[model samples]
Target: EKRAFLAQSPQLYKQICALAFEKVFMIVPVFRAEKFDQPTHLNELRQMDIEQAFASDEEVMNALEECLAYILKEVREKCEEELEVLGQRIEIPRLPLRRIPYSKAIEMLREKGEEIEYGEDFSKSQERLLWKIVKEEAFFITQWPEELKAFYAMPYEDNPKLVKAFDLIYRGLEISSGTQRIHDPELLIKRIKEKGLDPKNFEFYIDCFRYGSVEHAGWSIGLERLTMAITGRKNIREVCLFPRDRKRIFP
Candidate 1:
């Protein structure tokens, strides 16, 4: 029998910690076996992950917005000379950033004459076009289609077809993504089955909720992606000292 190899994401572990700690944050390495090579993608990277118990998606998004704005402000104030050399300007985005629903985003794209479907994920070009249309340096796309998100994402109370999830887009690139996770064990199991996944494999995670659990939402920011956005770098690799992608792995 072939042994399964674990890849790093910190999704499950972070949630587990949130159950006990109420709020937690970590900067950790992540690994993915992505097949495609893109300027913004890497097989291995660092992520800043945060999870908070008794929090809704809206609250989590607000926290992320404030955190990102503070980071940019600090960079702007402390690294003026470095930014000047790079010809980069860090603009602190306004609070409570504009949120465009997934459905509305699809409509906007269609209006712009882009060939796109409602349920499909956005391509890189589509993301850039959306930035152009919105004319915002940073904003959020929220309430994604349920099928497009992970099984752990909480379904919207009003619409089962959608999830309480959001993505932070900066400079036409996704810097972070998050969701209000499903806390009910029954619902989690149901979602797992719906996704054609074996719940047995997730017994450890589900068992944690069986005892007691609170509502929680979390998000992760890709360190390299965030750096690229702040520095106005065209490629994520420009910010990462040792980038690992499909084509290159060695330092």
Candidate 2:
């Protein structure tokens, strides 16, 4: 935890594996210093990260989505007793969930009488509004403003203003955000600088790219969020086995 700030996903893992393995999937506990004690918010949670080297971000998404589809189905079949006890039913979505873009989501929101500017990221109330209408749409939203996403997401070729990033929204909330990662050392440094983060602090990561790396893409899902999606809980805390929040530190 000291050396590696709990990465929201395996962004570094994918980059490291790109040097050797063509494909890598790492599932681990990621720690996020979230501010709230919301139902889905946890300081420590499980994350499933899958990355593919030598593949376009689209292909990576396809692989990731396929893997999730299979796993969700398998869990429903194998964990019938558990689901029954929890009063939950997992609906396995089909391959190729619909992809939407920020521009369209804005338009849809505007049509519903919301006031929002083009440059801003979605606020919590804004996301709630989205869920009110989206209602069970298992889809991804891509081509986000570069400023809105993390530094690692690949910027678009045709339009540098937008990144090749995508966020998966299940039911209504954002479950995961993924993209083609920045592999070029110089470009990554530039992005880090632009994001107002210190490159020196991330030197250990910088060192890895100097040896060998490739274009890679992957994603991380919030375990609590996934559980809430499975259990139909609006607040994130409801799905956790033991709750930890900003207000409560001890069990």
Candidate 1: segments with Cα more than 4 A from true spot:
1-4
Compared with the true structure, what per-residue lDDT tens digits does model 1 show for residues 132-167?
999998999999999999999999888999999999
Tell me the deviation in Å of residue 139 in model 2: 0.1
The TM-score, computed over Cα atoms with residue i paired to residue i, of candidate 1 is: 0.97
C-alpha lDDT (0 to 100) for residue 73 of candidate 2? 89
Give the TM-scores of the predictions, in the order they appear: 0.97, 0.87
Best by TM-score: 1
lDDT of 1 at 220: 98
Local error of candidate 2 at 210, Å?
Answer: 2.9
Model 1 residue 111 CA deviation in Å? 1.0
lDDT of 2: 0.78
